[model samples]
Target: MTSGMAEDHRKPPMRDLLADAAFELFEEKGFEQTTVDDIVARAGVGRRSFFRYFPSKEDVVFPDHERCLDDMVAFLKTAADGTDLVEHACEATLLVARMYAERPERSLMRYRHIRDVPALRDHEHIVIRRYEHALAAFLREGFAFRPDGPLHAEIIAAAASAAHNHAVRTWLRNGATTDAVAAARTALASVRAAWGAPPTPAEPDDYVVVITRSRAPLQDVLHHVEHALARIAPADDAE
Candidate 1:
């Protein structure tokens, strides 16, 4: 009655009941066959509560990503004020990888489920693009004064997204043999190093500098980064 652990009658939270029921249904009856009604019946909940918790059936597969995305954007915004935008953006994207890493078995199951369902695959892309856009938008705001801010911002954001995805896939494919968090960090570090970022520096370090003799195109600055990175041999391949 006190809403403490001793409350044996305390029903399993509706959210968990729904999620557990939905996943079990997906496994038993298959995702396509498991309707919202089926899930609600199993959980002993009603239609309205289901909608309150999730927007769609596919959402049940990865319920925490939306919260993780919100947390990531908050992290980027908090670090944007006179902080290293690139590093922060890179670090922020790790929330996705970490979310999955925190529950490797569930993550793997969801990954396989998504692979089997084309609709979920498409939905996954939308989710990933949102994170990329959020990172880019934050970088754009932070680098507003720079002449080539928008271009650089987009590139860095894309790189961060790619790093997180690559790390997560590697962890899953490797039989989850590596520490997922460490794998995620290493992937991000490789991206940072490729862009001449100091690997896990104690303090922020400037990697790219934008200087133009005239109103040059953004591509010119990007080209300089290409040449600079090409000059140095890469030590890690997002391992």
Candidate 2:
């Protein structure tokens, strides 16, 4: 009988070879012009080996996405119990951003290709949704006692994912500069700012004693007051 260890050794890193070959072919011939047989031929691997590595040619664009997502989930699971949920979700998203930044050129090429391809775009959307769902689950577990726990968790997850995507897309469109990670962090900061303060209670009994007048519109003034109150209020008190 053949030993399992021997068989594993004989596999010859087929997955990485196939993926590298597929990406090269896609870059050369365009995604629509590339075929599974062409990828296998370039890789010097069998068609069966190609299938064993990935279900289809399109999957080569994100060969390690599932693994990266699993890594994010594992990282999230290790976060402290009393950590801020939004901050934790942002940290999880940063893991994904770092994965892309690690291969900025390849990621930029894939991003450009995916944008023009309907199928790849759909696949990208599904992958992002999966990330969001994983983050939402983590947040829900972390903040179980919060009012509207699931909804709040989902909102934070969506915001974090959106921030990451926006940053990556911006980086790709701008020629994959070294500042991509910084841009991603900045985008995450915007999301954090959006959700940072808790909502303040509207005081119907209190008179709005405005001591000063500005050139700003009435709506702007009201908005500023609301934001100030939100900043001053305790989070749990607002809850």
Candidate 3:
């Protein structure tokens, strides 16, 4: 048992080994040029261990989102009822940004690689959608009584993800500095403010019916509706 304990400490965890190997290979051979076999060969791990940690090559480019998302879900579940859901969602989504901001070089590398590669970009979107879906699901439970609750939840979830992504992209494109994280926080805060506001009334449908006097003629009703619309609609400035 003592020898086994020593052996366990002797080797780096397979997950870390695979990640390090993957990034090193990505940097050396370019993301497109690297293969799973190449990464495993560099890390001295088997193919089985590689799959256990990451589902695809692109997964290696990003942090362990599986765990991060689980953490976010847990964080949300424990949130107090008094906390504004929108603000809490924004803060939770920032965790994703912080995961990247903590490792600037790796984050920048992954960001660039994803931008250059369409497949990786698609994969990244799928991961982001997972976060949005999870957030929406949590919010739906919180707002189950309302008719438009699900839609509102989805809107907030999408907004949260968009804000985080925008900040991370801005940071990567400009320069990966400490200022980047601050930029990310500011951007996330903006989303919380903009989307967190009271939702605007939905646009009217075509051919709306306006109730008036029972004896009112069709022409009078039409005029009433038109006048009401004109009052609400923006004035056209065109000459």
Candidate 4:
């Protein structure tokens, strides 16, 4: 094999190495007792290497969030928009649920650490807000035709984030044996029921047409068509 291929084959990424080392130290020493120095030592890397991957020890505790947030944004951007705006927002939040579900043991450990550490818990709120903002931004664009578009976007975004968090946290507390992704989907469905626009009342002279993928979810079709009909209202009626 070439030198670069051999290097890739022999070692995990430095980011993963640093995260694994930090999690190990956090488990043994506890979040408060574990230091950046200890984590770098365990990883066989220098302090600089740790800093390269994480801004601080707290950042290491929640390593996957940045990538998860990016995934959420991309998903929202390309997701079949034929669904209810609230449902779309809920669907976007599932990316985070999947991330936690992918590593249940690690998620459980991180949950414990967050519960025990005030600073880590506070940091986690900040991380969660980023995800909420991404969802809201996507929804805002979808609702742009309505005068209350921004308000609608923000409310649904918060609802989606709350539902996703509720499911994941409940699963973590229960030892994560259940399906986290399925739980999130169920919770989000409630958001769709609560805030999802109703189907446009069919009018003899008014028909709304929406273009979407053949494989798009049924909810998407209902949402898009409803919103399309809603925009056809008179200017004063829209207000």
Residue-wise C-alpha lDDT for candidate 3, range 51-133, written one tens digit per residue: 87788888888656887898889888876966777877877877777777777888778887887899999999998888888
What's the best-to-worst order under TM-score? 4, 2, 1, 3
Residues 1-239, model 2: lDDT tens digits: 33324446555466667777888988899998999999999988678876766887778888878788999989888888556667778878888888888888788889888988999999889878989999989988877888888888888888888889999888888888867777888999977877654433485433344443777788988888876666555463668
Give residue 79's error in model 3 in angstroms.
1.2
RMSD of each: 10.9, 8.3, 10.4, 11.6
Q: Which ten residues in a row are the worst by lDDT in model 1?
A: 1-10
Question: Which residue pairs in candidate 3 collide?
Answer: none
Candidate 1 wrong stretches, greater than 4 Å: 1-12, 80-82, 196-239
Task: Using TM-score, give the best candidate's number.
Answer: 4
Clashes of each: 0, 0, 0, 2
Using TM-score as the measure, name the better of candidate 1 and candidate 4: 4
lDDT of 4 at 158: 91
Error of 4 at 2 (Å): 18
Which ranking of candidates, highest lDDT first? 4, 2, 1, 3
lDDT, residue 200, model 2: 38
Q: Residue by residue across 190-209, what tens digits does model 4's lDDT show?
A: 78888887656676336546
Better structure of 2 and 4 per TM-score: 4
Where model 2 places Cα greater than 4 Å from the true spot, the runs are 1-13, 196-239
